[model samples]
Target: MSTPTTVALPTDMELVLKVFPMPKDSNNNGDIFGGWVMAQVDLAGAVLPARYTCGRMATVAVNEFIFKQPVQVGDLLSFYSKVTKIGRTSVQVLVEVFAERRVLGNQYVKVTEATLTYVAIDENGRPRPLPITELQPRRQY
Candidate 1:
């Protein structure tokens, strides 16, 4: 088996979500299902864009997604995201997921990375212009 790649948690990106996978989230192999991870990623990826959109938005595209390591049950997952592009009505973000392995003394492994695009929407579910034209600096929580 290949060794899992250890990585430092991101300093520049905002931490959007933290979750622990339960046994129910695991597949037959005991690793967390990719679709479950993807769903969480989709939710995490929306966070940064929401700040700029300041309104309802929907994922328009998953530009890229890569799984670098498998997520095991009991691992604490942290998702970090940053806005990469701002269009007239869309915001693109890159999200990275890290798993803190308790079995390895809380070592962090980069498990997944994805790029996604979200479009601001009006009440009618049609695309609308973003509220902000440029990213505003904000304090990290």
Candidate 2:
């Protein structure tokens, strides 16, 4: 076995969402539930889809997810997302979660990352086509 090299995500990240986890969100073991973090990612990914799709959309799949670090109490979590790929009716977004430790001042670290796929939808909740946009390439992390 070998260690997987972690590549820093692109810096052209768009901050799509943010939220502070409260103490009540803790689990029995006192660690923040992974499910809560996932929900935040979903909400974060949905922001651009709702705008780009010009209507409602739904999460079709989670292509990849990795937890690079843990999130603890008093950490300020920020979710950054960007459109990585677009299709006729689907869009792929990469969401990165960074957490700022309470006692560490401005020091922050990447805590999680996930690739989310969403499908444009119409009022009836049926799949719809995506619109064209000037696609920009994100390079820095």
| Model 1 agreement with the true structure over 17-82: per-residue lDDT tens digits | 999989999999999999999999999999989888999999999999999999999999999999
lDDT of 2 at 141: 41
Query: Candidate 2 residues 12-47, lDDT tens each?
Result: 778776688888877787766788999999999987
Candidate 1: stretches off by over 4 Å: none
How many steric overlaps are in each model, in order? 0, 1
> Candidate 2: minimum summed lDDT over ten consecutive residues — where?
1-10
Worst 10-residue lDDT window, candidate 1:
132-141
* Pairs with steric clashes in candidate 2: 11-140
Where does model 2 exceed 4 Å of error? 1-10, 133-141
lDDT of each: 0.94, 0.79
The C-alpha local distance difference test score for the whole of candidate 2 amounts to 0.79
Maximum-TM-score candidate: 1
